[model samples]
Target: SHYFPEMRALLNECQFNNCLHINEPGCAIKKALEEGRIHAERYISYWNILDSFDEKY
Candidate 1:
């Protein structure tokens, strides 16, 4: 899921080939969030879109 373009760029750093960026170990996005590489507000925005996708399907 490339809903978040910034995260997409870091996908290769994740541990899994099909990582969802949620609760997955070695999630590059999560690591970035903790290390200040990614802004918290943008991550929160991602959650909003992720929730909407749940409703859409």
Candidate 2:
């Protein structure tokens, strides 16, 4: 949430308790991104970080 304050509240709004906000179903953060409520650039950066983790591990 620190990375994206806009995602803080929506985090809990996700369908699952463990929603990673990556590509999970019923992800509130994704929904907001799709609806243009959240900035696309920030979402892109978030994806980049997650993708980097894949390379590290």
Candidate 3:
């Protein structure tokens, strides 16, 4: 599912440029998670794909 326009806009305003909407510092996505705007599992799962690829290698 796509994020809302307002949500994307909010994410774009993150303090850092490398914000991956993950656990990185100053991440808008993490803030959104704290405020109940995003789900915990979904957030972790997004990054877990990298782990999945690592396992294959």
Candidate 4:
């Protein structure tokens, strides 16, 4: 939860609450990506693999 607090604060500061942190404008998460704070592609790959496991069971 280390990043959540700051992230929440950023979201709270955003113009909207339904932010997915994708390509949305004024998205803090996207800003983090631009700053190299988070890896978008890696996260997507990880989630894709995790989601694939659901079909195996």
Q: Which candidate is the best by lDDT?
A: 2
- Total backbone collisions for each predicted model: 0, 0, 0, 0
Q: Where's the lowest-lDDT run of ten residues in candidate 2?
A: 1-10
Tens-digit lDDT string for candidate 1 (5-36): 78888989999988777789988999998999
- Residue 38 shift from truth in candidate 3, angstroms: 0.2
Model 2 misplaced regions, further than 4 Å = none
lDDT of 3 by residue, 1-57 (tens): 124443465666677876666557777767877988766676666568756866999
Worst 10 residues of 4 by lDDT: 1-10
lDDT of 2 by residue, 1-57 (tens): 446889886888999988878888999999999999999998898888888888999
Q: Write the per-residue lDDT of candidate 4 for residues 1-47, one digit (tens) a residue.
A: 12444354456645557865645688775676678765667546544
Question: Pairs clashing in candidate 2?
Answer: none
Order of the predicted models by lDDT, top scorer first: 2, 1, 3, 4
**Candidate 1 backbone collisions, by pair:** none
Question: lDDT of each structure?
Answer: 0.84, 0.87, 0.65, 0.58
Model 4 global lDDT (CA atoms, 0 to 1): 0.58
Error of 1 at 29 (Å): 0.7
lDDT of 2 at 24: 89
Error of 1 at 39 (Å): 0.1
Candidate 1 Cα deviation (angstroms), residue 33: 0.4
Q: Which stretches of candidate 4 lie over 4 Å from their true place?
A: 1-10, 45-57
